[model samples]
Target: MMDMRDIWIVIIALGIGTFAIRFSFLGLMTGRRFPDWTMRLLRYVPVAVMPGLVAPLVVWPAATDGDFDPARIGAALVALLIGAGTRNTLGAIFGGLATLYLLLWLL
Candidate 1:
């Protein structure tokens, strides 16, 4: 179990990290307009970040016996298909959850 001091330390670290990141951005952008190229690139940041973040979790789920799980891959595929088809975030989440649950039940 974590103690109060540990929790305080964690909170302080998170606060400092958040402040530092925000400060850096605000400091850099102060009294200056961003370049068109930078703005255009920022527009695709989400498109790049989302796949980079989700791809790993889908490809490399933890296994029961210390091995990679294939079920996550299938569920992620189903989720991606549903999201692409419907263009809906909730649809993708529900589709993924249902696929994972059904697979878990079957296995």
Candidate 2:
């Protein structure tokens, strides 16, 4: 357990750090245009970030206590296939969600 004062200090430090990270971009890059290469790289940020954020959950979900669950894997595969084939983000998300629920209910 942490002391109340220590908790407050940690909270304040985290807040300041988060603000600094965000301000670094929104403050300094307000008027400047990024180079073409930088823009091209940034365009793939979502494609890179989504998988990074979701892969762990799909592979080792907390609900399953890190056990391998076919439903989640199947849902991920369905989402990937739909997204790749249709290039539809919303459709892929809904399809994945539906498949997850259906598989969980069935399995």
Best by TM-score: 2
> Candidate 1, which segments miss by more than 4 Å at Cα?
1-7, 26-36, 63-66
Q: What is candidate 2's lDDT per residue for 11-106, written digit by digit as tens?
A: 999999999998998688988999999999988887788789879999899999999999999999999999899988788889999999999999
Name the weakest run of 10 consecutive residues (lDDT summed) in model 1: 60-69
Off by over 4 Å in 2: 3-5
Q: TM per model?
A: 0.64, 0.83
lDDT of each: 0.82, 0.93
Look at candidate 2 and tell me the lDDT of residue 31.
85
Q: What is the lDDT of candidate 1?
A: 0.82
